[model samples]
Target: MLLMSRTDNAVQRFIFENTDIRGEVVSLNNSYLDALEAHEYPEVVRRFLGELVASAVLLSSTLKFEGLLTLQARGDGPLSLLMVECTDQKSFRAVAQFRDDIVEAPLQTLLGKASLLITVDPVKGKRYQGIVPLEKETLAASLEDYFAQSVQLQTRLWLACDGQSSSGLLLQALPASAELSADARSESWNRMTALAETVQSSELLDLDHETLLVRLFHEETVRIFEKEPVRFICTCSQERSAKIISTLDRKEVESIIEEDGQVAMDCQFCNHQYVFGKEDIDSIFNEKPQIH
Candidate 1:
């Protein structure tokens, strides 16, 4: 069964007519699966990764900047951390860390006393970061709180993932023009949020963008924009790994060589391992460092 069609593997933005409401939809299949294959995550971690992947895509699509957005969750549970990063170029990467015997449970069950951290890094500008405590029952609810606090906008999000495929929908009230009254904008936001809350996980993950829009907002007119492709691309290599190794003290490097006969570094995002034996370490120490 085809979970995501080639034509459907893009981020889409839409706006409602005669209202200050905007929304985005993202369906990730290949990118979601690629992130999963990078590590042997538990079932709970897998689900969290899926949600993070979908949420990252949805958030990146709505932003009006050319940069990267990173979504991460850290907790004091069996599942320690989960992260997803996506750039305006449509490239992305993700990874998760968890104990082997993590129980299969809901988002709250797996991540006790957790927090969500979002970072936006522009290619040529200042970066922005937001940290929100995980007080809600689900990842989607926590994100809604983040949006409410950061943007002060009425926002709703529906996120879902089934190991292989992940998808999400986000709707937010836009800042109204000077002519529009605050009460009018508030009323419109409440009405649209009510409509957005009825979205089912099955519909969000399985249905295409057009079908989803029609099912959820048939009563309203929404202008759908062209979709942008989302893909999985890891930015890790031996050269980068070597550069990182160059940062370590020479004593620390020699200690690893003395204990294990070699030093190995693995890319958490791609699972690509780089090994440096004594000779490799010597060459690294002997050669002049190049600016990376």
Candidate 2:
């Protein structure tokens, strides 16, 4: 199924009634494509970016701050870096770095000796980051381990991308709620996760939130909250890029402008290009940069 054809770009949060298990379902269409269009990525990079996007959105739901959460992977192989940044408002952008001649291969071969980094940058407080070895073959597995060790949450993620759209399903074992015996609580977590283990990529991409939930948990009571919208929003602009140029040494910016006639730069995240003329350069360096 083509997930881009789906009209709703939303993430649905749901909980099993009388249980402490909460989960999220996400589908990406335009946002996923927007992130990929800036560069011509290989098949492996495309699919890898998709999974990272889905995972970022899923992890963003767990934060309580109005800031950006970033997931970064880097290694010594042909594929050097995979980065996804998502905001608390459910918007995201991603980028990757790789050698020009790298071919698709196993995860470790594409990105040998890798480590994963999860960072939360709150708008009003200190940032926090957790680092772990990317010892798993799939991004999902690495993330599952991150949650297990870093947050002490039993989290499972299923992420899929087919070069057009990306989708993900996340199941987390929250603290046990009241109104259940210890046995019932334990059984509930175990049984629900076992059922979720049956979910396939096709089911996640093809099924709507409600139908998918019903299909998976019809025998179990569940409550889905209002769906949240997800969007493709980039934090790049001519204004911001110019400020970065301002921070550089004045002579270097002038030398580059003299040689190339202008300083042209592309945003690392969205690949949006920005060009600075002589006047723009002077204004940036001689005066304070204007921000909107």
Candidate 3:
């Protein structure tokens, strides 16, 4: 059997003509479910991961290089780690680890005293990582705080997820570009963000990007660019899994093979399994040099 999903999985970039502000709107449907299908997660955990993936897609526009952006939240509570990665090609993957016996709690309680790490890995330039304390009620608020403190940019984000789909909106205040006064730029940013704050989760999840933009910024001259699709994809394969086994001690690998007849491994992200017999292990070590 095949299932068809009708939601739009894409990102649209927008800017106002007379203002130094830009933003993005993203919606995820089947792609969101594809990211979650490899594992069985609780409802809260599923929604949290969905929001993370949506945010990653929205932020993927900031990557100027041919590398990737990773958002990681880690702590000691039931939800130990939630991570998502998106590349310049608009491909994304996400995974979450949580204790099963978690109680019903808010984001902070579920994550304990966690920190959110935003990392940008460029192909040619230096890598950048910024850490923000996770103290807010939602990931959107925490990310907005990150831009304010780390990048000194006025930014705002609204994120939402139903169990089946996810959506998000982002507004960033750019520097004065048209010889406009500093106060005017700030005012433009303020009024635009204030209007966006009135949006509801249902609106974000249900309405298309054009309809939602008209609803929020009918009075402003919003210019939306060509829409780009976003997809859920995992970058795991037999070669990479083999490389992992080749690095282990030869004796240890042999012992596992002796007992089980094959060394078995699985990728937690996509739940893909790889098994290496003794001959396969021998070739992995003897056939070629390691790829680092």
Candidate 4:
């Protein structure tokens, strides 16, 4: 049977009625392409970036604070770093840094001795960081392990990317309640996740959120909330770029301008260029002369 095209970059949250289980389904289209266009990434890097962006959006939806959630994977291999950031407003950006000669390979080979760092930087509260070993063959497995250990929630993630579009499904067991016994909650979680495990990668990438949810949980009573828009919003601007130059020593800034006539700053996440001419450099240094 044929499926309709998936919805635009958006996320949908759903909860099983009378059960302690919740889920989020996300599909990324233009947002994924926006980040991909920032750099000429290899196939393996593209695949991993897509999946990581999806996961970041899914995890960000679970946060209640007003700040940013970052997922960073660092290692000493061909793939050095894979970073994705999602803000509380449902916007996200992703970037990947790898060797120039990187090639598609197994996950472990690309990211040797890696660690996944999940950081929650609240706008008004203390920031928190969690480190999880990226020993699993797949990113989803490593995230699931992190949730199991930190949040104490049984979380399962299914992430898929075809080097173009990406999609993810997250199912998490809510806290045990007085009304729902542990045994009952376990049964519910098991049944729902088992049904979810039957989902195909193509379905996730092609089907709309509501269609996919109904197809998976038609038998179960699911209450889906309104869809939230996800956008590719980069936090880069000329003002921020100017601050970069103001932090450097006066001689260093002048040396760069003397050598190239101007200092060009490129935002790695969005590939936006911010050029500072002599006048602009003078203004920055004049405003912040403490930068000796």
The top-ranked prediction according to lDDT is 4
Query: For model 2, how does the per-residue alpha-carbon lDDT over 260-285 read when each residue is reduced to its tens digit?
Result: 98999889887778999898899999
Error of 2 at 66 (Å): 0.6
User: All predictions: root-mean-square deviation over Cα?
Assistant: 2.7, 2.7, 3.6, 2.2
**TM accuracy, model 3:** 0.94
Q: lDDT score of model 2?
A: 0.87
How do the predictions measure up, each by TM-score? Answer: 0.91, 0.92, 0.94, 0.94
How far does residue 96 in candidate 4 sit from its true spot (Å)?
0.7
Screening candidate 1 with a backbone cut-off below 3 angstroms (N, C-alpha, C), the clashing residue pairs are: none
lDDT of 3 by residue, 218-243 (tens): 99999999989999999888998888
Weakest lDDT window of 10 consecutive positions for candidate 1: 1-10
Write the residue-wise lDDT of candidate 4 on 1-292 in tens digits: 7776798999999999889888999999888998788788988899998999999999999878999999999999999999999999999888998988888897778999999999999989899999988999999999999998888789999999999999999998877762367788878888999999999999899999888988998999999999999999999888888877888888988999999999999998989999999999999989973421
Q: What lDDT does the true structure give each of the candidates?
A: 0.84, 0.87, 0.88, 0.91
How much does candidate 4 score in TM-score? 0.94
Model 2 bad stretches (over 4 Å) = 1-7, 179-183, 288-292
TM-score of 1: 0.91
Tell me how candidate 1 scores on lDDT: 0.84
Candidates 1 and 4 compared: the better one by TM-score is: 4
